[model samples]
Target: MHIDQAILDKVNPWLEATFDNETHRAIEQMMTTSPKELEESFYKNLEFGTGGMRGIMGVGTNRINKYTLGKSTQGVSDYMKKAFPGKHLSVAIAFDCRHNSKSLARVVADVFSANGIQVYLFSDLRPTPELSFAVRHLKCQAGIVLTASHNPPEYNGYKVYWEDGGQLVPPQDKEIIDVIEALDYSEIKFTANESLIKYIDKEVDAAFIESTVKHASFNTPQADKDDMSIVFTSLHGTSITVLPDTLKKAGYNNVHIVPEQAVPDGDFPTVKSPNPEEPEALTMALSLADKLNADIVVGTDPDADRLGVAVRDNNNRMVLLNGNQTMVLMTHFLLEKWRKAGKLNGKQFIGSTIVSTPMLMELATAYGVQCKLGLTGFKWIAKMIKDFPELQFIGGGEESFGYMVGDHVRDKDAVAATLLICEVAAQAKASGSSVYQELEKLYVDYGFYKEALLSLTKKGIEGAQEIKQMMIDQRVNPIREIDGNRVVMVEDYQSSTAKNLLTGEVENLDIPKSDVLIYYTEDGAKIAARPSGTEPKIKFYVSVNAAIDSIDDIPSAEKQLDEKVKAIIRDLNIN
Candidate 1:
């Protein structure tokens, strides 16, 4: 079954002739020195998956490089031509502060321009959401952002967006992938039509800032901006250029930026990873907060689509709130403000992914606003907006600190989240209450919901097979209990069906088939399992909730939730 060495030798010469000089050199170097590495890299081509191409930057087929980027762009350009022939094609391009990000963006721009597509390229780094916004704002046919989001510093990515400002879905994604698979080294166009590429910076920046600031309900609630000291960090990426000014414009004069992490550097020298989801990345901000007695510490990842916030607890120590908790607070705060502004019409609705805490649905139901649940990705939320024209999507978020406030953009927007969170904090401060106190009030009003996410990464070729087998095992024999709670239902997104464990009945699920499963308990506790789309990880999402009558029960209630999670992990045999 093994291929002959003679065939490989023959194919190697073809590869050298086909690839560009840099790519050929990289491939030759790896093949001569690290044969195993070369095979792992070039055995299979870089694929356009659910979120497009993302991987570590290196010289291999599996890694991201100018050649790979050019190939993907060429495929997309070719598809655009066939999909919309005899029409003027336009695509917007943006990037983050990752290594070689600007260079990659320019390469992509050149490829598109060479294909005779008009390009709207950002002159400087911008957030991912702004790229989504720009696609719609400029009426372009499609868009691209050079960012790996909250991934580690060694990684970079390229995300594609359609004219609707959402990532391509269904048929388009499949068609694009097919076209990319059919392409070879010769198919990629490297020549640049400089005249066709337009560099845009200040115009979009001003527009995005204006739109984000308008989302703020109460800008200046406190008279003394100096009293509310805040420390902010960009984690050595984008957001420094506008975030500080945005805070100042929102009437916060005493905001401090983390000096070591302020400048836009791709190396991310101050932190091991650029992800704001991890506490280590936010260490600089938290340290500054502790030293300066700041009210809040905020950090945004490289592309600024996700946010991390730390608030002072009763013990006067900074506590980093998880994604679920932050989303809950923002949902509560925004709904209240909208209701007070007489903006909560009957058509107003809020949304979150199925894996998010059910607290938002409970709260929205109480507020007379509809709570719509979508699949994990923000594109599904965008799909909902397209499907339901009557209902206005107020906000949507995942448990990963990504949130979107309005329909202006189709992706998770950290800028809007930043504006809203600060406004919420300012209002709480003006009322002489802490943000934690507001969270406690929400818990009391809408039941205490505590959720935890456990992600197990299985690396390399063998790891992928292991993850696949695990999914098969779970589907065949489902977990029936967690801490003695009776299992009520099992929602398998992959099958697009919900199984009634007791009654042995099945019902159809409305969403598309995805490799995700959720087990619901009779008492409302839930556990969800899914393999990550981008990384080599299988994630477990656990949620446990109880009704709280008073603030004093927070300790016991939290303990119970913790025990439930631990028990579930034990029963599930997760490593």
Candidate 2:
């Protein structure tokens, strides 16, 4: 492969004396022997998306290496100085079980301290939610976490959070990106100011665990807790650090861990992908649950910000629940609890993403609590919590296995979610019902909402362009029908407009602009197309719903919705 001049221009800087000898040797080897690999690594700089940056870890501008992380930290430091001039700025840092996470965290703290900023660094690996809590608890100006969420082992990431304990949004994100793009390799300060760095542990852990426990709403007797057998797996991530203790503190004794995946290994040896959303990732946990005859099985991602759950069905077989199902179960349980406790005064609301099942909105409406829709990421949900000061944020979640219980932690919290979910399971057991039975009751009361997600990954530079073109095609040439259902409305988030094709009218959508498109069918099906901000892929989300008259009708209704999703995918030619 021929290396373009632009790629060479980006790679030349690493050959300088400023970069370490190890990095230089790696780059030299790639350039000499692997021109194709060299081009992919140095073609362009890694993007600093709305939340933060993520990429393959290597020795290039496009990778998550020491130099790229240093530059990002320096840019953040510069922005902090400008954003809060003449003030003592401080930041907190945490890392997950990913490879080089601890070392990269130290490097990031070094950059922040070198910039004359105080740093509160975690003494050991911690979950992402704890990092968010530490930011507000310590009264720091910002926070950073080093983990790739659920990506493959070869990948890593840096997530930035503001004082509100939420990821960066709007003007702040753009401002930080501007500074990062303008920085040269020489501008990053790699030296450490040891005096300005403080190692924090135990105290923060106690506070975070306590806050998580307070979110539990279980009123079951001690006997119920003993009978409710729970199985959990961390997928070799940070959840193992806190979940067991949290569950134990919440009065659950019959808890078992999938020993194969309990150890925090960066390689994630037990699973192909450490994502709980994937069924294969939870295989070990489900097998263990089957052997132990456990009541419930839960799994969290690497950063412990997302959770996936499985429960025994009527046939007494362990079955995995989709992200939407988990969200629905949690939301319904909390809303009912609050209503019974007389906590619903019309000042409470739940949050969800637009791509999630609309059943959440219906549930909130039935309970007389507002439901707000954000974009794809949980950061938007956190931002909604900050935007609405008067309204109480009961809980919020997305369809990608991420959720938040209360306002304690601004980001999606798997630790708190896992504990509360177990409590819900226990409560159901006490009432002589199972989780699956409760879900059937919900569908019988409200409706059956089925959702499916299809992600198409395109690798490298050419793949990125292909994904962009796919989005463009969908935006410009909107589909008229799907599965014989006429498309009634189309929402183009990038243009901030919703067009009623049947009525020939246009209305404004009150939300931030993003490159996403949604189509609403006359039969109440919704299809959304959006590209991934952090990964090289385009995702399509399909949701179809039908009214269920009784629990016996669930199988047919589910089959119908499944067929509708398949038809929609076929109409869009997504395959």
Candidate 3:
């Protein structure tokens, strides 16, 4: 095997005395026996993206381990100190049910404490949203959670949040990355300051659940809850910690949990992948729901920040709702309730990603509320909330099964979403309908919107280059038409430009610069292409909609939209 000298130079540092003996032994074994693995692991340092660092767990610069985490923590600590000089600096830390998560949380706490930053660390595994809440509730400057979210078992990650309870954005994200890049392993403070590190659990948990319950809109009578049967699965993650209790507190009684996945296991033994977005992840929950004849089934990812749902359709069969469908249901429900409660003023607004269906904008307009569009990621949604402090942020969601209710927790929160969705089910039952019926009614009132996401994974170092090249090709030779429909407008978020091919006019887009391209067809079809910031994959989001004249027209309208999406995909030659 041929090894690049630059890779070898990067690997030599792991053998130094500064690294632990276990790290040294792993590096030595890889160097002698696995040249290919060694090259992949040492070719470059794991980057701290807009959120934070994530990678496979191993002993290499490219892997996520103690040294890498230490450097990241030290750098965040340094930035916090410099940013808030002469102020009491502190951070909250949380972990999920993944390998080495607890230990990594402790390591993070120790590093923060060693740097004289007060650390409020969870005593055990907790969900990601609670960490964001703790950052605000504890009056800390930043927060960190150790989990790779829905990634495979071999993967782990570190997500950073700022004082506003959102992930780092813009200048802050770039500044933190600069500090992290300047850091060396030896510069990391590893010693633990026991006095500065505080362990918190029950108190914070109680506050978070209270906030979740309080923010939930329960317009239906308590008797409605008795008729709603809900089945929930955490997918061997952290939702088991608080979801059940939250449901009970929210006046739910007929709730059944998928016992097999209730346990917080790091391996996620029951599913091929513990992502709620994938139907396979919710298989056991759906099966159990069928057995119990439940009304709704909910599954959350390992970190419990995102939620996937399966609702009983009109045919009395369990069907998985896509992220866009679920978001529409939740947003519509919230907006309706707010209007009935006389809470919908012009100052209220809702948010959704640009990749999400445009139905949310229609709903917002119907309610006399403003609709805001951000780039992908909940952090951007959270940034929207931060930017418009004068407006009431009722709720917001993305197409990837993530929704945030209220601004109590600034990230996508499954706990609150789970509770609110159950409430929706109860309200539907009371109104002589089901969740599916309500969704169809929404389509009839608005238009029928269908959305599909295709992610093509490119693995390893070579795959990274391929993904970049694919984006470049799309930009250089743009697609002017899709499925015989002329492309009306082209948006390049990276350059913050939007061009109308029909009118031959160009204008600047007032959104953050990101490497994303979107095309709007003459018939209202939309397609967006963006590479995954955290994974080695590129995603294509397609949305198509048609008017539904009545409840009977929903099925045909849905079919037409589905066919349009397929046609768009075929035109782009996207597999």
Model 3 spans with C-alpha error above 4 angstroms: none
lDDT of 1 at 172: 85
Candidate 2 deviant stretches above 4 angstroms: none
lDDT of 2 by residue, 445-553 (tens): 9899999999999999899999988888887788998889899999999999999999999999998999999999999999999889888888999999999899999
By lDDT, is 1 or 2 better?
2
Each prediction's TM-score against the native? 0.95, 0.98, 0.98
- lDDT, model 1, position 159: 93
Cα lDDT, all candidates: 0.84, 0.92, 0.91
lDDT tens readout by residue for model 3, 245-349: 899888888999899998999999999999999999999998999899999999999999999999988889999999888888999888888888898779999
RMSD to the hidden true structure, all candidates: 2.2, 1.1, 1.1
Worst 10 residues of 1 by lDDT: 1-10
